[model samples]
Each structure stands twice: as structure tokens, then as C-alpha cells.
Target: MDWGSTPHSSTMYIWHLEGLKKMDLRLRAFLAPLLFCLGFIPLWGIDIQALVQEQVKSAGLADQLVSVTNQMLEGAIDTGKNYQQVKQLDKLYQETKNLKAILNPNKGASKPTGLGAVFKKAIEPPVDLDKALNLTNALQKEVKNANQDGLDYSKILSVLNQLENSLQTALDLKSQWLDTRKAN
Candidate 1:
């Protein structure tokens, strides 16, 4: 019980006795897993945060919406295929534009036309306007609950797929409508 200096413990300290003893393999085996779990505890929070944030970062939920919206609007201004869909959706066009603006506040909402953006546009498989609109609305919902937990991204993604298909359908129908009118 004497920690420092005492007549009864003058030869050696009590703490040193543990170092002199042989540790059991059973204890070492059990402690390894426990120590690893303890060591990993701090990382769980970080990984969860990173996952949630990743789902909304560039190429994440938010960025995916941006890419899709750009395609919709550009298609509207260009070929007039799904121009009406872009004009009339579950949300307003201005709102979609505003939400896309928040992709990178530091960049002042300028459109992403860089090489990476171009490559992504080229490589990204077809995907939605209403679903794109839903994501835009979710992003602007509260700016706090703008993640997977607060948003039904699966449904949004599903709707995105539906939207893509619908656009393709519209183009097919229009092309067919025009074919019937070809004067030969």
C-alpha cells in the first residue's frame, strides 16, 4: 500500500512485481481483440460521417443531381426533346437552377464544364428530371437534413431512372409521330 518511500517496501516498488511475472497466453489472446475494438472505436464516427458526406459531395447525391439537371436543361435548349418535362416537373425550374448553384458555393454556382465534368457527362449512364427535381428539393429542404437519413434517396434514384426512361419514350413517340408525316 505504500506508494513511494516506506520502510516495509524499501527494496522494490509494488508496480515492478507485475513486470516480473509471466503473463498468460489466455489473457493476451482475449486482450488483443478488446484492444483492437477500443482502438477502432474512434474511427466509427469518422467513417459514418464520411459516408453520409460522400453521398452528397461531388459525384455524390448533390453532384449527381447537378449532372442530370444540366443534361435536362441543355437538352431543352438544344434539341427540344424533353423541354416540356424540364419546364413542368414536381418542382420549379428556378428552384432546380438554384439548387444546382449550391454544388460548390466557393465557385459561385458556375456550371461545371471542366474536363472532368465533360468526361463524366460522356461516361455517366443515362438516368431523370422529376427525380433530379426531387433531389434538388431535398438538398434545399433544410440544408441540415440533406442526407440519406433525412432523404429517401433510393426512391429518388428510382424516380430518376423512371424519368430517364420516360424521356427516351417521349423521344421515341415524337420520332414516330414525325415519321408518319414524312411526305414521300
Candidate 2:
């Protein structure tokens, strides 16, 4: 015996397909925010600066580590002695490039050692204040070394701006974390 669809059953099946499609769309819409909250997407106070710094230090490229940190601090300041602007994507790109040693005082074979390799390392989150300070001091050394002839005032300014921006971002993160906690 053949089980065939009646006219009424065919119409019901078409409606069921349409309903499934609508349900699929609605399900996607509902999941968007849920996934975002679970960190699949960015939320308020997301700090890319911290992520950059973590990667820089983990690479242990030493020289690039310092340069990147300095640039982050400086970029923060340039953003209006404010922290949010420090993580500006353009500024981050410029500093990341500098940290990677793509732009350097030396040319070709003369380029600073380990600059490129540093970026290859995966970033690790800071474990303590001592580690953070060590990173800061190392960055200072790189600036001093790079400026033996005369400091690049422009570079200094940019770094200062980035630093300020990073600090602001950190503060913003803290505030948001607190707010979330309170709400919860």
C-alpha cells in the first residue's frame, strides 16, 4: 500500500515548512545576544590593550615587548589623557607594527634581533604586579636604547597617549565588572 499525501496534508506540510523556517530565524535572533553575553562577541569594556600586552610579554622578544608596552601607554594618553582612546584600532595597529619591529632604526640584516619572532608567541595574562613592572622597565630600556642619538619625541608622544588609553580601558573594565556584579 502506497502512503500518498492528500491535498489537505500537502497544504499542512507546506505550512509546517514555513513555520520551521520562521522558527529558525527567530531562534537565530534569540541566540545572538545570548552568545554575545557568553563572550562569543565583544561586550562593554573589552580590553584589547591587555590582550596585546599579554602577547608581547609572553613572546619574550624582550625588546619588542618593551616597545609595545610603551606605545600602549602613550597611545592611551594621546587619546585625551583618557584610556578608552588608547585602544583605537589604528593606534593599536601602529604600535603592534612597531612592537613587531617592522619599522626599526636598522635596515634588513641590521634590523633588531627577535622583533619578528616575538609576535609569533602566544600571549599570556599577567600573573603578578612584579611581572607587569618588569615589562614596564624593559620597555623603558628599549626607549633609552632607541634614543641614544636623540629621542624620537613623536614616538614618545605616541607611546604616552597609548599608555593613557590603556589605563582608561583598564579602569573602564573594572567599572563594568563591578556594575555587572552589582546587577547580578
Candidate 3:
């Protein structure tokens, strides 16, 4: 099949047809998976812009929690009246409840399991939710145990300091999360 010696003959035509067939098969093999992967992009891709916006909102909420905690500490320190102290404690409790709501919107819902849990954990920021909740609980307990005759301002101050510190830690976590998101 000396196709090179007979470039204008039927043998040359046959050789050219074989080369075209081989190239066509290689092209199809390379393109098929590429097309399949492209088709799945819409299914798996996350909206980075929306995620960044959510991070911003979370950071702002963390800041607000810190501010409300500071106000609670100031209210406890400046007022010696029992009724006023009770009122301030109630306000602080309400603010903590609000912060919890903002941080975990599905608080009462059953937690995800298996692969769903893994994915949820992967997306969540590295913050100690349990520590924050425990701090809030301690604050509530301290306020409830206060004496009506004369509130123990020192104990209340100590609990308030712990709550403030927990809130500050949350704020720091949010800030770090935002910074990481921006960098990526």
C-alpha cells in the first residue's frame, strides 16, 4: 500500500480517510467527559457573592451582641436599685435570646445526620456555639439567684464580665471568618 508513492491514487485516498477516522475518535473521547462535567456545574456550584453577603451580616450581628453585652455590664454597675437590676438582667436575657436566634435560625429543628451533617459542618464557621450558650445560661442563673433584700453586685458583675468575654470571642470569630472569606 505505497500510498506515499501514489499521492493522487485510491490508496492515498484510503490512507487519508483512516487518519481522519482516528482523529475523530480521539476528539470525541476528549470532549465527552468535558461536556458532562460542564453540564453538572450548575448543580454543584455555590454563589460566592451571596455567601460573602451572609458573612457580612453575621459579622454585624456579632458586633451588635457585643454592644448589648457591654450595655448590660454598664447598667449593672451604674444602678444599685434591685428593680432596675432585674430590668437590666431581663433586657440582657432578651438580647442574648435574639443573638442566638440570629446565629442559629434552626435552633429547635432536628440536627442533620450522616452526609448532611458533614456538609453542614463543612459550611459552618469555626465558632464555639456551646460556650456562648453556656455563658448566657450562667448569666441567667446568676441574675435569678440575686437576693431581693440587696442584690450581690459583685457576683452579677463577674457573670456580666464572663458574658461580655464570650460575646467578644464570638465577635472575633466573625471578624476572622470575614477576613478569610475576603481573602479567598
Best by TM-score: 3
What's the residue-level lDDT of 50 in candidate 3?
43
What's model 2's lDDT at 167? 37
lDDT of each: 0.46, 0.47, 0.59
Give per-residue CA lDDT, model 1, range 1-184, as digits (tens).
5546677574565545655553556678889999999997776555444433432342244445545545545544565444344453223334545544443333332446779678655754333334444554454442333233222334435434543443344344445545755799
Q: Give the distance in Å from residue 33's predicted Cα in candidate 2 to where it truly belongs.
A: 2.9
Off by over 4 Å in 2: 1-5, 35-40, 43-127, 131-184
lDDT of 1 at 136: 44
lDDT for each residue of candidate 2 in 96-177, tens digit (9 for 90 to 100): 4454442222324423338554543333223232333344344445455442222233554455345434434444554555
Cα RMSD of predicted structure 3: 12.3
Tell me each candidate's TM-score.
0.31, 0.29, 0.34
- Clashing residue pairs in candidate 3 (N, C-alpha, C atoms within 3 angstroms): none
Measured with C-alpha atoms, the lDDT of residue 158 in candidate 3 is 54
For model 2, where is the 10-residue window of minimal lDDT?
102-111
Q: Give per-residue CA lDDT, model 3, range 44-146, as digits (tens).
A: 4344344444444544554455556556556656775566565766666576566556455545666799999888778765544455556556655655675
TM-score for predicted model 1 compared with the true structure: 0.31
Deviating ranges (above 4 Å) for candidate 3: 1-21, 45-56, 71-125, 129-184
